[model samples]
Target chain A: MARYATTPSQTVGPYLHIGLPWPDGPFAVAEGTPEGVWIRGVLYDGAGAPVPDGLIETWQADPEGRFDHPDDPRGAVARPGFRAFGRCPTDANGEYGIFTLKPGPVPGPGGTLQAPHIDVSVFARGMLHRTVTRVYFPEEAAANAADPVLSSVPEPERATLVARPAEDGYRFDIRLQGEDETVFFDV
Target chain B: MSTDPTTRPAPPAYARDAEVHPPLDYPGYRSTALRHPKRGLRLLPHLLTEVTGPLLGEDRISENDSDLTRQHDGEPQGQRIIVHGQVRDGDGRPVPHTLVEIWQANAGGRYRHTGDNWPCPLDPNFSGVGRTLTDDQGRYRFTTIRPGAYPWRNHDNAWRPAHIHFSLFGRAFTQRLVTQMYFPGDPLFFQDPMWNSIPDEKARERLVARFDYANTAPEWALAYEWDIVLRGREATVFEDEVDED
Candidate 1:
């Protein structure tokens, strides 16, 4: 006898609802911003449960590792039609995704050009404080090794912060707790 | 620009009728299993008043109040800046009476009570948990000190800049958001993983509040104004379906 496999419903889990909360106005400025990059990822608990209401915020550099604002003293490099900033809350399934460009290496303290990475902050209801994490690209392995931040983590744990490239772009998953948990700093 | 007689004319009335929908006995399908009254009833009041509290006066007790001392204890201490903002809906309107909670590291770059052991002294006065309600203007404010930059094992010579973490709940679960706010002049903002995660330039600036000379109190106190928004009732839409697969 042949048996059929039953698939579960997709709408049963938690969803994330995010938006921009800027004091000035709508976060739209025509010039003096970075290029658009795609920032997308999933949120999960230590038990691998999707946190539907989890809120994630990401900030990174433009492709040149230089910021676009006038205040950014790194000097001006123009990339027309690119907007570096965006905000989105995850859906109920604990899945959050954004479309932006990859950032270039930026100067760290002591004039060091830090590796290309995106800074992330995660907020969920039950969490006492926000969890801070980073997402690195796999292609920049050499740079990742040289990264002052990545080098601080143990060799085995470094892989947790580096995202693997997927068909559309890169995929990074963050775990709030438990084994294989991504290293979260207390900044 | 020039006005031209060759401009296209509006479509005829008959064409518009075809695109209109007639009222139906049942507008859309409903699911029995997921049906329930909305949960915003309890959260609405909190969302409305998050922004309008008495500004924290000078000489206020620190958010943390523990009598522990030692480095690498992961206690919350050090100088830190807390940026609180009110969240608004798509229409740029504030949803009042919400809850905003924030927790972050001490000046020495350690959290209040996490297991991580970064070598930093925790302040007995700073517990690092802050709560506030938005006011009638959809505004929320937090009184917090500046977080300190701490070193991590990720890099031999890397240290995170001072920052604060934020968690916001609007009128309902669907309107919640979590994020971190950074200081404007911190040099480490560029190197930190959390700050660089935001891809947009203008949006990234939004995370860093402008240093308001007027909001600055006497040398001892600092103040920041942050606003948050939540989706209102009419804007919410529900879809009914068991499974697509």
Candidate 2:
């Protein structure tokens, strides 16, 4: 019944790009896949500066709220091309893009149904440990209202986690510090 | 830095001295304190899934992906060395076929990054990047030069110990871990704040790699062995139910 404590985190450093980003690592599913839409955003630092060396990773369930993972009690994902996971590194301008489908709904704490949201983890220089947050779709206004995690945040601060819809996907900008800083969750 | 044990907060894990981890009062670690906001917040299931990772294939690997001793042509300039290690879970079980990537500064104490403006010559042949997969026994090895210590702007005359960044993948995406490995007799151990961040001196020592004399080829290269332990299985019985089909 003993638990092993994982090693503590340290700064991702200015040189993370050399080791973390592999060819097409940003694409969890092969880019240009038909069903999923792209999730795009810019990662910013405390001074409101763009974080060029940052890495953003996300995980989500399929449209039916099911995951292809072994941990998902609901069972395996039905779709072949959908990986439900993506890792994108920021460009010089601090922009990152991931092509994936919009997740539907999943179960929240207890019995409530959670809204469609992608778990986001931001890792960058000066960040000893990754800051955890979430990206919810504004289009899912109904589900977002009843969501447990979303309700936990103050009403004014909840908007930071909702992504604005673009032509094909959603736009969710992440701010590490300063005003309108993204709400980080303890995980 | 007077740390009042009476005022010190702990969930028991981080009760150690934070003053030693220099860049005293680092903003990056501010939110990790005992009284931080996120400490009491409950996490949802979406935040807990540990599945889905890049299933990297050996097809894309070049002839010398694991060899840092030589890149384009000629050998790198430095003391030649070999690093060998295994990836394991807390229960002492091998984590097989996981992707393990390592990056470090060149022998001249310069990283092959645009951010490094340090006045050091770059070795054209050494990019200082190496990637490999753990074998069935959870073992991996790489051949590279011993990285040199580099100065940082943390404090007065602050210098970081020579270290390599390692990324190890577990069965799922959430299980991925990133940590640094240091050489056993590095003089920087006492000075580097990051290495001393762990309150427990014993846990901090785990990060240091042991020198393996037998594996070192008489004069060709020195060998260092480091084993990494990751978060172990939690509620694994329920996890097995999903695969019963």
User: Which candidate gets the maximum TM-score versus the true structure?
Assistant: 2
Which candidate's DockQ is highest? Answer: 2
lDDT of 1 at B62: 30
lDDT of each: 0.48, 0.71
Q: lDDT per residue, candidate 2, A1-187, as tens digits?
A: 1134455555567789887886765665667877768889998776677878888888777787767654554445656676666788899999998888788777654456778888877777666556668899988898899987898888888999999988888888987766777787654
Instruction: Write down the worst ten-residue block by lDDT for model 2 chain A.
Output: A1-10
Q: For residues A1-187, write the lDDT of model 1, one tens digit per residue.
A: 1011111001111112212222211122232244433456777775667766665655556677755433233334555544344445556687876666777776554334468876665655444224457788899988888876778777887788898887756788877655666776523
What is the C-alpha lDDT profile of model 2 across B1-245, one tens digit per residue? 22432222211111111122222125323322211222223343333243443444464366677889867688889989999988887545777877788899999889998889889888887899988888898899999999999987766677889998887766655455667888988888787767765566777777789999989978689999988876555443323344222
Per-residue lDDT, model 2, residue A122, is 79
Q: Write model 1 residue lDDT over B33-81, tens digit each, in one string.
A: 1221111111111110111111211222233311211122553344333
Report the error of model 2 at residue B217, Å.
Answer: 3.5
What's each prediction's TM-score?
0.40, 0.83
